[model samples]
Target: MGQIQLQNIRVYAHHGCLKEETSIGSDYRVDLKVDAQLAKAAKSDDLADTVDYVHLNHIVKEEMATPSKLLEHVGQRIIQRIFKELSIVERVEVRVAKINPPIGGDVEAVAVVLSSSLPNFGNQ
Candidate 1:
């Protein structure tokens, strides 16, 4: 399987545990790694045979635009959306980073990362 890496994808999103964060919004950086068999696309050189990462990025951005209570939920939503929207994907790894978090203590970023595979692995 070939891998598609979409790293350090920045988005302005409203997602956090605190109410102020939700209303004010913050900078969110996402790194998505998608694993899939690209043999057909590689051989045929057809765009349809592979996942269109540009479209995938737009999907993730759309989900991030809406405010959510938890980053975990947002991350899961992103994962689910990828699986639901794209058929060529076999596995996905998502990392959501809240840049300049609202926590009391000083910090550069706080992030949540999640990885998941298709339910029917044997089919892959």
Candidate 2:
């Protein structure tokens, strides 16, 4: 198995509990990690054999375009989409961060992390 990491993807999106946040949006960052079997790609040196980072980026962007009430929901949707779209991916971890949240205090960012793995329901 091998891991692929896509870190610090910056996006301006409308995702928050507050009405102002959804209306104006905020700068956000996303980090994703995917675990998959990569022996074939390593040997063949072909993009088809591996999960393409560009495609992964597209997925993140598409999901981020949709507004959500919470960071947790946004992260969960991204992870679920990745697992559904990328058949080779066995597990995924996603982190969504809102930069300079509206907490009425000095804060750099607030983030939510979520992870999921495909379950072998039939095998068990």
RMSD values, in order shown: 2.8, 2.5
Under the 3 Å rule for N, CA and C atoms, how many clashes does model 2 have? 0
Q: For candidate 1, write residues 26-46 as lDDT tens digits.
A: 999999999989999999999
Q: Count the backbone clashes (under 3 Å) in each candidate.
A: 0, 0
Q: List the global CA lDDT of all models.
A: 0.89, 0.90
Best by TM-score: 2
Cand. 2 Cα-lDDT: 0.90
Candidate 2 residue lDDT tens string, 84-117: 7889999888999999999999999999988877
Model 1 Cα displacement at 75 (Å)? 0.6
Q: Which ten residues in a row have the lowest lDDT in candidate 2?
A: 115-124
Where is model 2 more than 4 Å wrong at Cα?
120-124
